[model samples]
Target chain A: MNPRDEILNRLQQVQRDETLPPPWQSRRDFPELAARFRQALTAVKGEVHQVDSLAAAYDLTNQLLRQMAAEKVVVNDERPLPNLPRLPHITYHQVGQEDETLRAFCASADAGLTSADAALAETGTVILTSGPGKSRLASLLPPVHIALVPITALTTDLFTWAASFNRQLPANLNFISGPSKTADIEQTMAVGVHGPKRFIVILYA
Target chain B: MSNPSSATMSQFRHSATVAIADIQLQGALTGATNKFVNGRITALTELPHANALRDHFKKIRSATLANLAHYLELFEERATTAGSQIHWAQTGQDAVDIVLNIARQHGVKLVTKSKSMVTEEIHLNAALEANGITPVETDLGEWIIQLAGEPPSHIIGPAIHKTRHQVAELFSKEVGRPLPADDIDGLTAEARRLLRTQFLAAGLGISGGNLAIAETGTLVLVTNEGNGRLVTSAPPVHIAIIGIEKICPDWDAAATWLALLARSATGQPMSIYTTAITGPRRANDPDGPEEVHIILLDNGRSQLAGTPYEEILQCIRCGACLNVCPVYKKAGGHAYGSPYSGPIGAVVTPLLFGLEEYAALPQASTLCGACKDACPARIDLPRMLLQLRQDEVAARLLPWRERKAEEFAAFVLGREGRMNFFTKLGRWGQRPFQHDDGLKLPVNVGDGRTLPSLAPKPFRQLWDEGAVE
Candidate 1:
């Protein structure tokens, strides 16, 4: 017999008597969504800044980039603010324009600025998906990741998100909670191992 | 009904001895396991329904396993619809052959990999090397061990046993330069610089599946480091070798599983990256692998279904049992001589591989029940361990000396007269080895545990002499 048939036959004959687990619902609630998101994100060494408006968020992004002395930034030109006003101090290389140049640019770029599709207030997770102009590298390759999150996109948790998720999921959807980190060497915390060293979230109400 | 041993018992005891005697290893294990154990406790306490979540996770795993065939078929159908090519492997070699053939077809010269215990279990890297494909491990712990030519020492943190000095030394040798041991960030930065090239140059990427959500035909991978993202996104072709039992019926089950996994493993609300791959990159998307493949590996996993050991299939590979296990804290991961270690490894290695070959594994535990408590799935490992010991006896896998001692003790402890006589005999025989308050056996026995000598006077003797209160 073929391997699949043999394995299936073996497993089919031996299944025990058990019922499926009862359906679950998320009892978790966030009366203060942005505050909870900030607390949770900041606990993992991720930066969280709440803004009163999108204009304020944009201003903070420019100030933060200028402070870092960032020379180049790869911005994902999709959703929330597809037309982020480029500043003189930072050279913006928008994604999906001649895609081959992305890897090298992201490798050399000082940071990647993007907007999330949704945010999880319970765990302070930002959900990003790949589509027309949202390149995966925009949130990945650079040394720093700056997310512009709108409070209207916030959800309670994964359970709450899954309950109403009806659209087809993209090939790549990432739930990122913090910056890259590892404690492999003698249990010492070392951030910025591979992906972004600094994860800054600008939450706009 | 007898199955003979392929791996001798002496090998098990010897490695355990070496691990116990190495002060460096002892210190590392204590530090790493203690922190993980304490962190898990603190993290779980923050949850309003931590216990309820664990129980629900247990139910989900149990229900999934009991209906493994149904869930697997559903997963295969959905994943196929999503454009993932699913391959079935009845054995480890079969899995390796599938991967090698794929590599050969793509003319892959180099492969970048995220941390996958399944690949380590099958020794996939060695096979890849023999086939002339250089595989680079991108996870920092995995990379350190790969560079040093050592297997992973822990399930979550593979190189926890190695000091920073050792890692610095390994990094220096690899780069042909000296590096300061005190600067961990420098070492990590150097590793990142070196591996970044591998990600861009590699022809293929491989990872293990944490959850194969049958609901949406998704593969969920959780990783603290961003290597998982690079492995899945950077390469043109990607392959995931997943154990057959890693399937969840739907997103609800998968969500609950995720809720308990990172907390139990590394005490995080969630890992840094939890990437869900539905299929190959859409034509409109600018990034991600062009081709996606899933290999469902069943190397002795299906055989445990419906048996007393079926609960072992419920393991999530979180390594919580290891952190809370006293024996694992002492012997470390190397002593098990398997990719898995600690209490979970103790029960799992023997059952999956061969009962006789790994007969000594079941004996490695203290049957403390802490493993069951610590397990996210609440698998009763001690119960399975007892059953394994019984299976060992039935198969007569124990050595002649051990069997004789057990048989003799059974005979003596079975009756009042025999028990009384042996009690006296043991007290007389204890003199030679008796020192202070403990009995020092002639042979090198357990790992630094003391066996107290028998009491000076028997209670029955005192009662007969009217000296008891």
Candidate 2:
């Protein structure tokens, strides 16, 4: 049976057995709720941007693609990785065009870069939701992920700024903060153990 | 039926100690906690009015919890009105029975579950498997652990202990392929494919409620994975296993808690999916479950109400305390041996199971008050821990060595005359053992810093020697 039919049958069974509750309706002030939610998210993300500008700008999709580039270093419109001492490579991936067949992409080019449409300022986290040609794995599986973020998605407090994302959500939404790290080994802080060794974000005006 | 409470307590003792010493556990904990704490601080800086918002949430929560019964009644009424079934389980066994009976009646062969710590605590998966129903874990973290045949160590990041290499290996075996070593995409795709099949074919979907509004009988689940939304809406049978204390009086109270929970646990202002399910699918509603069952499991929570530890119920199970605890860092969640691990686990496991079963957990703390500081609801963890210690002492459950040491210290301090003599001798006699730098010996033996190094001369001797007035 289809999912709907299965659910209907189950509901009917519950009804017959007297196990289900009496039906009730929800009354919500949608407009007011939406407005307040938006206001809160805006404020929160704005503040988060101030604390970690680069992290707030990361777009997981582009970050993953850039890291996969050939040269082990990708420089987008945002700028090149800082010299020093410790510079992780960045690569780029194409949107909607690339074959989803490639299991992994290593940088063929010296440096690749992809920019983000918006950044969430709260917690300096980058938001990456999945869609057509936007592989959710790209946001996660890469070793060093970098995102170029637009300044708009920044908010100070999370609750203040969350309302803007009311648009239909992707099947998966990943909120990434900093590089994947763990202190699991003897309480010593070690970064890039699993997800990413380094995470860089490039924010633009 | 056998009570595993006793066995659980012993396991808790062994694991908690190991957790205290495990360095890798510490690193994982510290990394997540610092990120969260720092992230929250940054987030708060943007909301200068956050204190006011917090106060509003606190007030709302207090009011909701105060009239929890009323809200729960209303919720039941409304949810039934919306064509949903609600069942109350006074204990864990009852909850398990309710879910099993439903599955049996339907002749369910397979069930898909989202991440619900409540199910873990009650060992629901095992129960289903014993009854020949294959229960699959749909959460990424949960799925990995299920493949490894272990319980979750961390609440938020269940597979936090696992390396990508480890995950790839596990997934590769499951998929029967020689997957690439550094292939993150391959692993994720493999998991997604596997879970989708489970999702589509499952006869039952069981989940845990983040919040249950009593007045509306609405159950809310906040998840990042579309799995949660799917688990409840796609499956024919949806059963929610929630603790009795999870009930909030109204939608306003739920909103207040949700506002803080996602942000606190994941730094998300709002989770990707915030589903408020009131009842079974409506006639007009295109999607949602047809049958919805909420099993309210009291377990051991009601016994704690109005007790000193009752404040623990206010905990939203955000796992923030575990993420930040220094001890939990060393000891992974398994070390706690109970479903609830870390500082909160330390207190709750024993209280729920009884003191004799978990005597060692009370002494597990360094009493640094970090857990208490990190708690969103201000569950005075250290105070509760100390109280447990006191109770242990009253019950004469204190280890003999500690009891003897305490008695000796008390006796010495009880007498002023002997104390004065001892104090005088303590200064003069310890001169030979004193180091030039005035540092105590590092070892526990007499050769080491067995006693506090005292001054070469007594206070009176200093006066006699004209070193003091």
Candidate 3:
């Protein structure tokens, strides 16, 4: 059997073991699916405001990164400091073709753009998974990473989140909220010490 | 051959003891953990249904583990479909052997590695070196400890114990010249220059997965410095070693895990770089590894299925428990002397490697229940620790001295009718053992730190004096 068939089979097995009705089978059609999603989105309403369109989100991330740089939150001087501006300098390179993208994006950009899963209003987190075209580094290697948000990807809670997910993703899926950070230092809140200090949700029109 | 592991553990303890007393270590640890704990608190507070979300993940983990075999099979199939090769190892050594074989097949001489604790568990570096291949650590923290020839003290902050001065010194020695003062930028520059060379020179790259999706065979790597990207992309052949239990059945499930992992660890809403490697380079692809191999190691994790400790496998290894653990704060990871250290380590070490070697580890905790509170997957760590302690006692592993103390204490408490007499007598009799501050006289545990002070007055005395209503 192919991978899709195998995944469906396993998911069916889990449903059977849990004695849960097949979620898809129980729903009559698209209307029910839409209703379920509506409920999920409603639950995540408070978190929704935190999500911004891609461009605006990048601005927010850059602002945070610049502030952190000024505060000496991160101590890397080998790379040129990112120059803050109203808009993030956008660059596009095919996933595998570009090696400089990782370095240029890591050292220079405020946030790198990639595709996103539905915007989660509950946590204000944008989801990205690895696959054929999306370079996994585009989401992670920058100072402040942003993803172009898809409206349809929104979920209210974790269960709702799982419902939207394909049982088998190609290789990797990452759910990002805002910025990369660690409290590994003396428990002081230092942004962007190791990863992006700020993460932003970019809602695409 | 000498037992490198035991010797390593001993040396680890020696360094940790020195680190524990170091003001810098204390400052870094206190600062990092408190910020993480407090930030998570604020984030969780902001989420209206945070408790409900925690419950949901618990349900998922329970349900998932119930039919894990099915999940694994599905995951293997999906991963294969994505043009990835998946191999299984029954043990750590088996996992290492598989990785080594892959390295040899590719004619790998020098391997640049991102930090993977799973690889560390099997002593992959030493094993690879013994076989005549060199593995270099690319993460700044991991590289420092690698130079120091020590195990990581803090999982997330591998070099948390090392001061900036020490880092500069290490870098200076490497360059055969005195570097600048202990400045963060200077230190980072030295590391970047050195590791950049290795990244370009490496024949293969090895990494550990933060999460592995069964649905797509995607390997998720969350990093800050962009090192994971390099290690995965720089080399022609890439091998990722992950524990089988790291699997989440689908992207949605994996995303939820990431939500909890990011927030619980370091209080990040999202990690800077969460890399997902799907398969080897596609026909049109330019920069990824030509051959991608993912080695999934069961290594005793499967044995945990259908057991109460099954929840332990749900851990994303965020080190949140370690951060909040009071015992861990004092004793540190080195004192635990296991690859997996802290609260999770206390439970997992005995389970994975056997309790006999790590008998002291479970006893290390004060049953504070902080670990349970800190767990994102909501693993009932305190309860598990208690169960392990009972098992120790049942198995006659509890020290005779402790058993005797318990017996005497039980006798005193059991004789309720004579409690008053003993209470009065004990109060008077314990005077000689009391210190100036009314703490018990200092007695040695294995560690050098002094025991916490005991109370001067028993609660019963205050109650008798009508100090309590």
Candidate 4:
């Protein structure tokens, strides 16, 4: 017999209790979502800047980039950052460029800026999906990642965030809670071993 | 390519004895397990309705396992529809062969791995090396152990048994120069530099899925380091080996699992990265594996269905049980002499492997019930241990001396008169061995453990004299 059939047949013989308990219902009401999200994100070494407007968010992004002394920046092409003031000295790698050297550019880039698809307030996680003009490596390879998330995108938790994706899901969905970190060495926490060392979220109203 | 020295179950007692004597191993285990235990407590305390969430997670796991075949078939159908080739392997060798054939067809020279315990259980690395394919472990801890040519000691922290100095030596050999032993940041930087090139160069990436979403045909991987992302995204070809039990019914179930997993394991609300791969990269996608293969491996798991021990399949490999287990704390992961260790290992290893081979494992536990309490799924590991002991007894797998002792004890306890007679005999017979209120046997016989001295007078005797009333 084929291994699949044999295995399925074996599992078929097992008795199953047909009655399953109801799925877990998460409480979605969080009046202090911004505060909660900041607290959770900060605990994992992620910085959250809640701006009153998109203009403030753009200003903060430029301010943060300057503070980190970042020179090369990679921005995802999904949403154009038209309002953000561009610095002449800073080199920018725009997404959707046909340059095959994009991988190397991302590896060498100092920071990656992208817009989050959704945010989980409970865990302070930002969800990113790969699609047309959104390079997974842009968010992954750079040393610093800055996500521009709107306040409306914030949900209670993973369940609520997942529920919003009732339509077509992307090929890949990344739920990133904090900067890349590892305690693999003697239980000592070290950040930025592989992914972005610094994760900055600009939450605009 | 051969199995590690500690792979055999016969070495369990010897390894455990050695592990107890090794102060470094003891300290490492104590530090790591304590951190994890404390973190889990803190994480759960901060969550609202954490206990209810765990209960819901348990229901999801139980329900999924009950209808495992249906979920697996659904996952296969959805995955195939998403342009992924599905392969079924009933045994470890079969899985190894399937992977090797894929590698051969693609002419893959270097394979990057991202910390899959299932791969360790299947001994895939050894098989790959035997076929002349260099399998590089990209996870920092796994890489450390790989360089040292040793089996992983802990589930999450594979090289937790090794100290910084030992790691420095192993890494120095790899780099052909002496590296700083105490500098953790420097070490991580060096590892990142070395593994980055390998990630870019490797032809194929093999990872283990944490949870397979049946509804969407997605494989979820949770990792703090970006190695998981690189392994699944960087390489041209990607293969995920998953056990049959890891399937979740739908997105809701997957959400519940993701909610509990990282919190239970490392006390993080979520890991740094939770990557969900639906399938191979589409035409519009810029980067990801072009080809994706998922190997559904049974390897003794199918036989566990409908059995009393089926709940063991609900394990998410969170390693919480190891943190709380008294036996695992002392004996360490190496002592279990399997890919898995600690309480979960003691039960599952014997069930998946053979009872006679892992006879010593079930006996390793103290039946303290800490494992069950720590488990996110709330698997009754102590109950399973008791059942395994009963199975051993019924199978007559115990030594003749032990069997005789049990039989004699049963015979004595079956009757009140015999019990009283033995109590009197034991009190009198233990006099010669009594010292300082404890029985002091020879070192070779007792192995440094002492039996508590009998009571000065029997309770029954005192009751007969009306003194107890």
Best by DockQ: 1
Task: Estimate, for each residue in B29-123, the C-alpha lDDT of model 2 and write its tens digit.
Answer: 56666766675565554544555555565555444445445555666787777667878776678789999999998889999998899998888
Off by over 4 Å in 2: A1-205, B1-27, B414-418, B421-469
Error of 4 at B424 (Å): 2.8
Query: Per-model C-alpha lDDT, please?
Result: 0.89, 0.61, 0.65, 0.88
Candidate 1 residue lDDT tens string, B134-221: 9999999999999888888789999999999999999999899999999999999999999999998999999998989887789999
TM-score (0 to 1) of chain B for each candidate: 0.94, 0.88, 0.88, 0.96
- Report candidate 4's interface RMSD in Å: 1.4
Q: Fnat of each prediction? A: 0.82, 0.00, 0.23, 0.69
Q: Ranking by DockQ, best first?
A: 1, 4, 3, 2
Winner on TM-score (2 vs 4): 4
DockQ of each: 0.78, 0.04, 0.16, 0.71
Docking class for candidate 1: medium
lDDT of 4 at B220: 91
Off by over 4 Å in 3: A1-205, B1-20, B176-182, B411-469
lDDT of 4 at B148: 83
Candidate 3 C-alpha lDDT tens digits along A64-117: 445544321211111111222333333433344444444444444445545565
Regions of model 4 farther than 4 Å from truth: A80-85, B1-10, B428-445, B449-453
Q: Which docking class does model 3 fall in?
A: incorrect
Candidate of highest TM-score: 4
